[model samples]
Target: MRVILALLLMAGMARAGSDRPGDFDYYVMALSWSPSWCALEGDARGAAQCDPRRGHGFVLHGLWPQHETGWPAWCDSDARAPSRSEIRAMVPIMGSAGLVRYQWEKHGRCSGLAAGAYFDAARRAWTRVRRPAALRQPDRPARLAPAEVERAFLAANPGWTADMVTITCKNGHIQEARICLTKDLAPRPCGADVVRDCRARAARMPPVR
Candidate 1:
């Protein structure tokens, strides 16, 4: 009886550990503000993103598949890292090679696609959204309310309502904009927990370098 009970417990534990890809309801496409990321990465500025010549604006951070409460990460067993070519392909959009590898290991593993296909999906999601012109040409540093920022994004991308996106900030600086998508990559409303407005009344946007 003791042996049988132990086997039952092991089976239950195995079932609890079984989270696979395609188990998510939606995805959140995160786009980082390059200048904000550069500022945040302070002495560690050697990243390609920190270089002014990169001419980066909102760069792909990652396309994270999210559950309502928590998220599934590092789901795949093979756990193969992204290749050099895969890293190179993402550099233009993702900014740095190290970030590319990290994103794959953390988020892409749970994406149900190989590294290449995962990045391809990331690119597809990146291209699907439009960056607001105001954000693109912030020649001088400016402060804008989070609602204003969301409006700019909504204006640029028709059909994306306020509930579909959220702005993230760090120390009064706009950091990233996260937009939720259906599994098929169409714009969708983010859950109440995921779409909170920035706490600050206004957030600064550093001038593009």
Candidate 2:
């Protein structure tokens, strides 16, 4: 039931240029992963690869690259993480098959995931030529709220555990791009500014022990 979302390129930490509207096919919901879990196949673009590919959690983000055409891309955060219970809540109400169906039914009519755009072999990346109005707005990264991020994190993982979070963005199987988190959000880089923000958030959050 797990499929590696191709849109993950948006989550890449490599360097890339900017993308215009309609440049990409759509934002993607990456398979369960933290920034560090990502992996690169070869030395092609100096990509990083994660070992023991762990994706055992519910979906948490909808990352999109700043650009789709040039080099390393910037990732714009989309949907805040959804609580595991919230997604599963619909299971009984919607049925396992019906849950996914209900999701598509409620959002697919205007969703981008259903658009079926593509990543050409020559371009070696994803591009969007067709899209639904819903995808245009709802899934847009600009709409995400800080509270939503916290709430979603709380839901999916009643006790979400992450010592750190690193971010990365990629172009197909090519280029590597890194997304920079805010001052309040925990970043993955050792000396990266994210460390400061993560420490701050940790200070505010309830003690885990």
Candidate 3:
């Protein structure tokens, strides 16, 4: 991915504030806190991941490329949409076909690889991060500090440090955990601003139904 950025820059096609394909330094893998999403969706339950029987835990929100300043979006308008089989395979993590499609059109299009290769890379990146045991669907609601959440992740995933993570929250509820990785998928430090976004001393992690 870093090579893609360099090539685009050399061609002078990637400029500041432009959504050029492959214009990014590293990646941020967002792991959504499913219970928080279910709580927000309320009784709608229209998405497959929201089904109570599924017992979903930390789910993939996206594998996004990041710039030191601001990230790019919708880089390749002409990129082909992913097939039904590809979309279905991501449903276990991404929740819906519509979301899968949207993510590919926006983030994946900028990845320089074709749709299939992009999603395949996403799956590989998602699997690289080990989900912390405590955050994996406890029977009761889990109330924790932001530091504790970061610690759990660092302890579970070898070589992951505090600088490599960003915990997002709403009303003191954990909404997501965004982890930074190198273009080659190795753990790396996130931007300082991203790390400071969620500073809540205490947060609630709704129980997975």
Tell me the RMSD of model 3 versus the true structure.
Answer: 7.1
Whose lDDT is higher: candidate 1's or candidate 2's? 1
Could you list the CA RMSD of all candidates, in the order they appear? 7.1, 20.4, 7.1
Q: Best to worst by lDDT, what's the order?
A: 1, 3, 2
Off by over 4 Å in 1: 1-19, 42-44
The lDDT for every candidate, in the order shown, is: 0.83, 0.26, 0.81
> What lDDT does candidate 1 reach at residue 6?
100
Q: Pick the candidate with the highest lDDT.
A: 1
Model 2, span 25-90: residue lDDT tens: 223222222222232322243322221232111223223322222322322324333345444543
Candidate 1 lDDT by residue in tens digits, 51-132: 8787788889999978764567767648567889989999999888888998888778777777888898899999989999
- lDDT for model 3 comes to 0.81
Instruction: Note the clash tally of each candidate.
Output: 0, 29, 0
TM-scores of the models, in the order given? 0.87, 0.19, 0.87
Is 1 or 2 the stronger prediction by TM-score? 1
Candidate 3 regions off by >4 Å? 1-17
